[model samples]
Target: MSKKGDFEAVRKDIAELMHQPEYDDGSAGPVLVRLAWHSAGTFDAETDTGGSNGAGMRYEAEGGDPANAGLQHARVFLEPVKDKHSWITYADLWTLAGVVAIKEMGGPTIAWKGGRTDYVDDSKLPPRGRLPDGAKGADHLRWIFYRMGFNDQEIVALSGAHNLGRCHSDRSGFEGAWVNNPTQFSNQYFRLLLSLQWRKKTLKSGIEQFVNFDEDSETELMMLPTDIALTQDKSFRKYVELYARDKERFFEDFSRVFAKLVELGIQRDADGNITNTDNEKGGYHA
Candidate 1:
């Protein structure tokens, strides 16, 4: 068999193993996406190329990022899968898990590709300040992602991820998740964003304030200053509105941009191939 055939066979095996109860703890999916985000978020256009394609967080220094506090769990969870399917790199596995989790959770179908290779040493680790602070506003949002080459529309589409996970006080010092149904993926984030009338809340130490969108009916969702700015800014709001109106459009755009995000900061092989077959079996392990 050719190398590609061997790779696909390993992918099928990994996909089958993913259905076993040993792999399902219920927490790994979202955390895996978070891990992918943290890994890729470290990229800086000026100097570092430490995005999801390298699995750079295995190094002590890279894993120490304040935003990546809980990511060790994801790395540990994938060890068995990595060991069994040694053909795929950790960087590719982690990001592919994110894509699987999003689709499994009833969200968009993320078109995935994979060409990541493992790093031989810690010297290649990226510098910090790549992930967005939950306490930041529009300017901070722009500066962080723009340096990575993302435009305003891409930023807004990416924020849809807020729909999947909650802000951990221990992890990010931000309280509550973005949506009530944090585990399930949907367009509820945008719906709540547009319908809710937000009021500012005072905070003790953070640079940003919490927003109360609709406290009484439990329809109120808190937004970080950066998340709120999406609606406040005219250009960003245009993208938001488009996403709200058309789920297909949002899914299509997100698939392209998120794939691009995961692809940054890594060297691809001459083949330029990105494999998406890490796990093809449907649903969680348990």
Candidate 2:
């Protein structure tokens, strides 16, 4: 009846629609997470702007980021929800879907707020070099995420996102899924990391490649140099060990850190309603 009631009703409708078979497929969930990843990955602390908080990628420049290749699928997936609930912006919808995807897939609950606004103008798209390159090692990983204000623990926590999605040959120029069961959420990534003996592949491009030492099977699942570096590097390996030992810790840490990553540039009101504000340089509530 009232505007508030209408918004609540719409929210419920959107939530229910999220359960539809089309959206339930594992592909959509991982893709949605990737969308949120590309959007928020653009944060630049020095410039004091760019992140999931603004949902700026709806514009051309940001949408066109090479790291965001194949994201149109996610945008199309959310089109109906956006049309029905015009009050919710694309920025908010994309990040919220990421949270929902994580929860639905047996992952931890991601804390979410909804203040992101959509901008059609491509000028708002952040410059490139925001998303981390899968080809890089520890130094590059540190440099990239740290630029966005993430610490080593947070970096390891967020890398757990590889838990959800795979690297597409067309998308990242790397071809292989990380886990055997890409759709299912588990600490298997960590398990495999610890248990498997890895050997550098004979085929070497500037990019890194390593095959599992178990029988040299030709399955498509592959780990990036940085992903393997987690196990090799002592400091990063500690957190990975903690995650492997306690799945709960991985889920908890991931939920908190991911919430922070996506909420990087929005503000909220006293009631926790994300307000319409231009401020885009704050952290999300843990």
Measured by lDDT, the strongest candidate is: 2
User: How do the residues 31-118 of candidate 1 rate in per-residue lDDT, one tens digit apiece?
Assistant: 7678777778777777645677556688777788777887887777678766776666677778877777676667777766665656
Global CA lDDT computed for model 1: 0.69
Candidate with maximal TM-score? 2
Q: What is the C-alpha lDDT of each candidate?
A: 0.69, 0.72
lDDT of 2 at 213: 38
Distance (Å) between predicted and true CA of 91, model 2?
A: 0.9
Task: Flag regions of model 1 displaced more than 4 Å.
Answer: 1-27, 120-124, 202-220, 267-270, 273-286
Please give the lDDT score for candidate 2.
0.72
Candidate 2, superposed: residue stretches over 4 Å from native:
1-26, 120-125, 202-207, 213-218, 273-276, 279-286
lDDT per residue as tens, model 2, 34-93: 888778888777775688766767666777878888898878877887777665667777
